[model samples]
Target: MKANQPMVKVISSGKYAPSTLITNEDLERLVDTSDEWIVTRTGIKTRHRAVDETTSDMAYKAAMEAINRVNYDKDKIDLIIMATITGDQMTPATANFVQAKLGLNHEVMSFDINAACTGFVYALETAASLLQTGRFRAALVIGGEQLTKIVDYTDRNTCVLFGDGAGAMILEPSTHERNQAFFFNAARGDTNNTLTVVNHIKMDGKRVYLFAIDAMEQAIRKVLESSGLAIEDIDVIIPHQANERIIQSVSKSMGIPMDKFMLNLSEYGNTSAASIPITIAEYYDQNEVKNKKILLVAFGGGFTWGSAILQL
Candidate 1:
């Protein structure tokens, strides 16, 4: 590795989902939806729900798992960046609560970012930028959401589309030749009320679907272009586990094979910020990603969307 090259590499990843499983059949009792309808449209059969667990609790669990994966030194972690739309509290940042729960006594910079489903990608980019400054050695980037808390169960449209979960990752300076990661994040303020969560989750399903497809395609192309890499060069693409239809559309539009995308929404639902990182953690746990190039793309409610290319 060159001495002047500043590279932020992911060291480990972890994820946590609640024990309570809400199956499509279960939704039939609460709403007017059926297993066949949801399965055919969203590819979701079941989703985990946080009955009593807070967002910070899930975040802490995921973070601990990532730290334990490598027996990482907690003292070396100087930063914690958590991404979520449904935090435990509105006063102190959710990251602060996680830091405390982890028993970190050091003075670490802990904060939270809210970009809805695209939050994990935004947080990853932010952590990489701060790590490249050469001041922080290791940092924890987490995405946790108790999204079921905000979903209006009375409305079948939004109710069937969300769940609760968390995922985390540890990042450190890299010495490998191909350890750098590239990112492209952009968002347009939502004025049309296509997607919003004021009193409860509300969205124009058709409008949001159109926006998601376009955003994913553009974000993927932008990141690959910036990294000077071709589509075939990517080993895996982990997109936000929003809807199966969006992923299918992007696959068709980009001429990319569906096998290249890591998908688990069928089991976890739309976990918002937690989706991509959770998918990543599960993928790394199941596959050999030692020197692979992974692409991540996400689109969410703030009209937020982003893409990232990371070399493992």
Candidate 2:
């Protein structure tokens, strides 16, 4: 980051997954895939379903969790950026619904970003940039998805790979230099429609797998280079919970240890944009990450990929 730019600090994070869960066994009855196959391939045992909850509902709950963590002043939050392809509706952005749910009946700048699984990182970078302008105070950055609503249960290829959940982070511009943030978010056009959602989710598994490994590795390297930090300088890495194989591949190719990556996909599957933030929330719950240098990386549909390095 430039010296003239404002710094942003992440105050808190929270995540929410609905009560309904679809296990691998449940999928076995619905499709031809079995428990062992699903587990061995995706490293996902079960994925949560929204049931009656909408995308905005999960987003609101997640934002509330972060707000209540420090009893943050809701009125101070003037910006809300949500990431979700499975929104409640198309007219009003999902972030608007989240703002209403927060009871912030004020002039808040709110919107949504559809960068697929890389949505959270994109939203975070956008929020930080806006905050750096000194135009916004506290901001809510959320990644929520109801992918189950769009997933085709009959298609074994994509049916076992998604879930519904939301994760939120509260950020504010900081004067402390230690609170600086660095990010890289970009995408490659997908003319082939390798991974897409049109009424229902569809994907070419082999193509996506190949793209994911390369995209994630590049993003990680770019962000680390931008920050002039080596992999050892990062206390932990939170990667998009897309597939275990992709992450393992990046780790091996980069020579980074598996333990350095914070992973929880075994329980949540791929929550699209919600994966990274949800894993971050869970990791914070289990570990002391004070003053830690954390790296976040992701790749998704749109052939989008990016990374961020944050001091927390």
User: What RMSD does model 1 have?
Assistant: 1.7
lDDT of 1 by residue, 1-312 (tens): 334434788889999999999899888999999999999999998899998799999999999999998898888889999999999999699999999999999889999999999999999999988898878889899999998888898899989989999999999976566897888999999899899988799999999999999999999999888888899999999999989999999999889999999999999999999999899999889999798889999999889999998887
- Global CA lDDT computed for model 1: 0.92
Worst 10 residues of 1 by lDDT: 1-10
Collision pairs in model 1 = none
> What are the TM-scores, per candidate, against the unseen true structure?
0.97, 0.98
Stretches of candidate 1 exceeding 4 Å from the true structure = 1-6
Q: State in Å the error of residue 120, model 2.
A: 0.5
Q: Identify the runs in model 2 with alpha carbons over 4 angstroms from their true place.
A: 1-6
Judge candidate 2 against the unseen true structure and give its global Cα lDDT, from 0 to 1. 0.92
**Residue-wise C-alpha lDDT for candidate 2, range 1-312, written one tens digit per residue:** 455433789899999999899999999999999988988898999899998799999999999998887898989999999999988999699999999999999899999999999999999999998998888888999999999989999999899999999999999998888888888889989999999999899999999999999989889988887777789999999999998988999999989999999889999999999999999889778888789988999999998999999887
